[model samples]
Target: MTPEEILPDDLMERIRGRAAGYDQDNSFFHEDLAELAAAGYLKVFVPVPDGGLGLGLEAAAALQRRLATAAPATALAVNMHLVWTGVAHVLAARGDDSLGFVLKEAGQGEVFAFGISEAGNDSMLFDSGTTATPEGDGSYSFTGRKIFTSLSLGWTRLGIFGKDAAARNGDGELVFGFIGRETPGHETLTDWNTLGMRASQSNTTLLQGAVVPPERIFRKLPVGPNQDPLVFAIFACFETLLAAVYTGIGERAFTLALEAAKHRTSAKYGGRSYAQDPDIRWKIAEAAMAMDGIQPQLASVARDVDALVDHGPQWFPKLVGLKVRATENARAVVDIAVRVSGGSSYFRGSELERLYRDVLAGIFHPSNEESAHSTVANAWLGPLEM
Candidate 1:
């Protein structure tokens, strides 16, 4: 089904109406979350037999793009849950049912949030500063802090990982697992006040000594990047879904610029609409062209993931490139939209103002600018000599 059919225009309008208020109050999108859950949006990536829409990655990305057009913060936060479900689908398709339970729980209305991000851990999933101590009973205790834990106020389960320096003959192993919100030693700090995307409530989390049973400890790979299906699934879902959100931001900004250009009249132009002004039209066109290039790239990467197209070493480059393009293009579009809309968009409450802040958050996500460039460089040029 099309994204419009899945999310519908009226739902988007309602969500859009509340976005500004949520930003103003630095609040979570509780009402929007409830509405989305009721619509089964959270289950978009779960299997059909599991009571979800069973959408492929491409279709899910489209829906996320549409969702973000109305409420980027809400869509960004929801992407966490979708990422896990998407990861589960990816694993299942590859004959690895390790995360099958995630899909099942999602179908049953359980919310899962990503908790892998850590302060100063620039290596992203490849390495961790947190400690995962293995217990004699095959369980592990995680003791470290996690930053940017989206859906922090509402998630039932949080997927996290850390390194066990003593495991695998002191070579160090990365332990992946999930723990409940009420799990002992897990603390969610009320520290989400941010410049944008405030509704996401992506607060810092402190894991003093959270335990994960054996069944929950899914993977125990070496301390760096490897040929693991888990790695592939995480990168594929995270990068693709993130790109979709930013693409939607750019799409919305482009539309707003078009509307502004058509409606606003310039007295200096003798009552002609700004749409008739050469400079305004040029800015609008430039934003449109840049924004137009993002959609197909988002769709192709997502489709490749769903189809298991083997890019091999090129996969990371492709994923990171799509994310960087979408985010940077979205920022440009928002800038053009603000310019084309005149000083009115610069007001404290204008949608463009909030979006400007929200779009900036994209740069700080995984596969950041420097890391993305390095990944592409390494993929083509190989690691630096020595």
Candidate 2:
């Protein structure tokens, strides 16, 4: 299906019109979420039989990029739901139906949100600050805090993880599971006020004895990193989808610059349009070149993941590399766009201003510049001597 089918231009414009208001009010994309759900966007990754589009990762990435071009905050918030469904699809395709329920629920109008990120938990998936205490009745109670929880206001199910301190002979076990929003012992804190992506409303979440039934507890693995299908699925969906969002941001910024170049005039250059100015043209060209270089890489990685083409140990490197490239290059494009658009972009009401702030958030996501660089270096030179 085309992006136009997934996200109609009329709906996109509606969402775009509300973006500034949502950002200014520091509110969630309630209207956008409702529209997206009604349109079955949350089920993009579910199988066709499950009443979804059944698109592969490549197509989903493309659709997300398009969505972000109109309303980045809405697109980023929806990405969490897509990530969970995408993970289920990936597992099912690999002959593991462990997360198939995710697809079924998504198709049934359930919203899934990611609850993995925690404060000071740089270990990402390998370790967790939360504790999952097992009950004799095959249920586990989680006690900890999660940060940067997107869709905090609307998610029906939240995918969370914690460390089982007593498991694996005290070697520590990482337990992953899903919990309902109505479940006792969890609180969604209304403290999402931030510099950018305000419509996402990603809030701090606290879990105190939140229980997960045995069937819902998905993966159990060692405390540290290892070869696991679950890990691969998470990285594949998370990184690629995230890159697509920022790619959309960059794409929009580039288009804005091109339009400004064509229409904006320079008093110093014989009343000629900025498009005729060699320096302004150079800036646009530079931004276009940088954005052009990363598009193929992003497309290739997403398609390769869908094709199940194994890159072995290099997979993490490639995924993180694509994320870093897309995000950093997006920042560069936005910067150039701002420069080309002149001082008007510096004002708070400018679309370029909002995009500038949104693009900055890319560097703060997982596989950040620091972690990405380390991963690539380790991939090439092996672990450090120390």
lDDT for 323 in candidate 1 is 92
- TM-score per prediction, in order, is 0.99, 0.99
How much lDDT does candidate 2 score?
Answer: 0.93
> Alpha-carbon error at 262 in model 2, in Å?
0.9
Clashes of each: 0, 0
Q: Write the per-residue lDDT of candidate 1 for residues 1-386, one digit (tens) a residue.
A: 78887788899999999999999999999999999999989999888898999888999999999999999999999999999999999999999999999999999999999999998999788899999998989999999999999999879999999999998889999999999977898999999999999999999999999999999999999987798999989999999999999999999998889999999998999998998999997998799789768888899999999898999999999999999999998999999999999999989999999999999999999989999999999999999997
Root mean square deviation (Cα) for candidate 2? 0.7
lDDT of each: 0.93, 0.93
lDDT of 2 by residue, 1-386 (tens): 89898899999899889999999999999999999889888888988898999998999999999999988999999999999999999989899999999999999999999999999989999999999999988789999999999999989999999999989999999999999988999999999989999999999999999999999998999999898999999999999999999999999999999999999998999888999999998999899899889889889999998899989999999999999999999899999999999999999989999999988999889998999999999999999998
